[model samples]
Target chain A: MDTPIRVHGLTKVYGGGFRAVDALDLNVPRRSFMGFLGPNGAGKTTTIKIVTNMLSATSGRAYINGVSVMEDPKTALADVGAVVETPEFYPYLTPMETLHYLGELRGLSSCETTNRGRDLLDLVKLTDWREKRVGKFSKGMKQRLAIAQALLSQPSVIILDEPTSGLDPRGMVEVRDILKQLHKLDVTVLMSSHLLNEVQEICTDVSLINRGRLLRSGSVADLLDEVKARKIDVRTLRPLTPDMFDRLRAVPGVKGFAVTGDLSFSLDFEGEEDAQARLLIELQNLGLMVVSFKESGLALESLYMSLIMESR
Target chain B: MMEAASVVNNRERLPSDLQQMVTVAKYDVLKHLRSKRLLGLVILEALLLGLTFALPLLLGVDPTDDPAGYMSAFVSWVEILVIIGATMFAGDAIVSEFQSRTGYLLFPNPVKRSTIFVGKYLSTLGIIVLMLVVYYGVAAALVFAMTGGGTLLSLYSMLLACAYGAAAAALGFLISSVFKGSTGSLVLTFFTLFMILPMIAQLLPAGSIKPWFVLTFCGHVISYIMISPYPTDLVDSISLGNGEFMEYWTYYPDIGGSLAVMGGYVLICLALGMYLFRRKEMVS
Candidate 1:
């Protein structure tokens, strides 16, 4: 199969004896939207940097278009576009100048650069402010411009590191929509983000990492299946008293329970959906409370915590 | 995911490489040409030249009495222009990229770093040279109209002086590439070309240095016309009051020496500048 990106024995060490990334192996198929999920300080940025040819790898190889990043970085990165970490742009130039400049650098003809630059500006919804100097742009505006610049080459693969780290709700939704549109164009996207909900929303596949090591990598559905099924959060109007909480845990199908806060307690169910029904009845019969009951599918926050805690 | 089999099956090699390099160079030249600071510096030099040569002849000095004497005054005017203009022009040719944070935008392109160094440096030099030529033409016309003696010879001397100015500008450009800040480079260029070189000539024993040192080094190269009026007795004297400065001093450039000095300064400084530029991590 034609993989857009493949990593083998990838590792990185910083100056002060810190092994920022251990020997890690990864594969990303072409045209797939893959979420690179990792907590803070988990080497996500380092891996993206190495893959994009920004940082040299200590002892590994990342390949793009079958070209080795280590052996021939220029060609290996020829078809890859990336915005690793906070995007930086020349503040004095307008978006059009910045995009056209990059387009020319990538060998686009003047006509082609102008045409493509126009289209990319429209795509990022910055066509109106194309002439405004980037220095005066808001953070969201800059991020949009960065995305425009990244897509100017129409590369097969695009990597973004926490591309939505500091955006308002509207900005986040806008960026998410842009990612979806890019996916529809068949660009293989490898995005690193700590926001689990954002990842779960857009990624078809995911690779979870923590503490500089890979915890799991697979299709999101398959990886979620591998995670130990956990408690279901039932938010209700009244709190379940300490005694009622214990009795709910004693329900035959229920294995254990943990109260997240005052109104909700996560009750672990061992069996199938029928067991979930049984717990609901027992709680109703006890006249405790039942505002709402639903299965919270593998809350990545808890999953991340459990994985790290269990490994330690 | 696109089938890996299909990707491997459809891989094709394209036959366009030279086009890429030309595209990069074209855009870089365009961007360099649009720099207002560079253009502004060039215009400013042109105005100063007009004020120094045309205004003085029109308002104050007499060139008709002694055609060569007026040419001598023109030599001093050109010297100040060369010193000030070269210092300003060359000092920011490289440092401004860093200050503007546009260094990353230019350096990481498909073009080789050396292409950028030569392309931008040469273009700036060309602009500076054009300014000098314009001033030279205007001054020669004014001198011809007034004194009308040996006009061709006077113009020949002016061209020689401009050549020396080009060398000074090149040397100053090299210093700009070496230093991080434009102001520091400007001050350094002035000190090296104006104060330091002349100071050394005065401090060194007579005849200990070569004739080139006494005849054509530092500002003396451009100001040699003003010194030609000096008789032999005042040739060795330090004062310009009694000295009859020649419009042209016939000391051929120690080509090897000139190359050695300029090449050492240019290549070494440019190498370090490229190294620093390449090593920059390009943080915004």
Candidate 2:
């Protein structure tokens, strides 16, 4: 199957010799919600900008489907919906007007534009404020309206840059819920974000990057399983001593441990679940008051941190 | 609920470039209509019309005696008003797309940059034309009411005024394409058209260089065409006490010459502006 987005050796250098994106390569498969994970100033936005033809690539090339973005953007971008950075619309225009304008530009008939625009406005939950000027809207409202605009064309692939950034808790959840709905609908989504938990929840596949370079790209399940590590938290009824720490370290599967408190500590165990059970038994065998013991699920946060640290 | 799968599956035929251009122009016109600037320009036009009628009445000059002279007088103010409309509508059209980050929403659409530029230019010109129609319509009605008839010179003057407005709008778009900020482009457009070019025309010795090279020189034809026996390139001389004569030449751009200069400006500036706009990256 043809990739919805493909980049090879894509490099973008801003003025004053700053390489924002350096020889980056990426591929987003069709019908996959790929999380583009990166930190601040990690060239995620730059790469999206180039793909949208908002910025010219200094070297190399990017393509949407089979068309080159730089050489032929009009045709290449015809089937693409994008929200770069934050959402900004013409202040004087209402959400309805904004969507109609964009929809007509994308070649929908007036009737179709109206019907689809109404549907999109309702989908984004902006139907109540459809006629109100966008200037009075809060940032989250604008972001939601931006998503509505992006989906106006019914694009095959959607590229969003930090869709949930700068939102309040409720706003974040609202936007995440919309994204979840999009995922269930099987829309090909490539969203860039630094929120590890958000990606872990919404994305099926992820590409982790730092300093404008790709670190890892695969299914989330495979990546978490490949790390072969688990964080096991244990709590004791009473304060432990140095002797107990030595005895805990002597467990066969305990690769590392940190004493979070006098009566509590967490262990990094690299083993199967049966071995983990054995380690739990051994902890009790060491004559410690092991009040509670549980193994934390593998987290994308640790994998992201480890990969970023390794790359640096 | 709208089916996301159905919408994604049903793809309509994309409109041609010309159709898209018209769509863009229509929406841009809607933007202007909703903006206070259009209302402001209309109010300014009404004020100019008030002056046009009140000035002649205050001076106790019967326009019926010489309708062409009245038109010539009115054309001067009309030119100024048209130029103002041009600058306001076109001066920041392109630059604002970048400065305000509206391009982030706009540039990703399926339209070409050239299409966007042309659409904006046409819309700005449309507003200017609309303004001129009102201004000239008032002028024509006033002349016909006072004199019992209208002169063909008014028609020629209106045509010249429109040509001048289009040229000025083209110049504004060129400035907009060069500057990254709307305020700078707008200020510079007004300064170049009103102050700089007029200053050059005033400082240069007439007959030395044609002054025809300046946009303001072509602008004179809008009023000059209204003159009954249109002025020629005759230099006026006044006698000084010391027996030396100070020469004053009123440079008149004949109809053909004025058309050529305005046409040159419209063609060159629009071509250059579109080229620059096409090449410009939305860095902001």
Q: How many clashes does each candidate structure show, in the order listed?
A: 15, 0
- Give the number of colliding residue pairs in candidate 1: 15
Whole-model lDDT for model 1 versus the true structure?
A: 0.66
lDDT of 1 by residue, A1-312 (tens): 368789888998877878877887889877778899887888888888777655567788888778887676556655666766656566657899887767765665568668778887887899999898787889888788777777776777778888898999999999888887775675788999998888888888888776667887878777666555655878877887877766776688777887877887777766666776877888888786788887775556566667767655
**iRMS for all predictions?**
6.0, 2.2
Q: What is the DockQ of the complex in model 1?
A: 0.18
User: What tens-digit string does per-residue lDDT give for candidate 2 at B200-230?
Assistant: 8876755456687788878988888877677
Q: What's model 2's TM-score? A: 0.92
Query: Evaluated with DockQ, which candidate comes out highest?
Result: 2
Tens-digit lDDT string for candidate 1 (B1-284): 21221121111221133544454444544544565655775676567556656776678765455666666655566666666656766666666666555553443333444455555555555655666676667666666677675344456556655555566666676676666777888898888777776566565535444444321253353444344442231233344566753332233234335434444545555566556544433332
lDDT of 2 by residue, A103-209 (tens): 88887777877887888888888999999988789989999998888887778888999999999999999999888878655467889999988998888899988
What DockQ does each listed candidate score? 0.18, 0.54
Off by over 4 Å in 2: A231-252, A257-267, A273-298, B1-4, B7-12, B55-64, B238-248
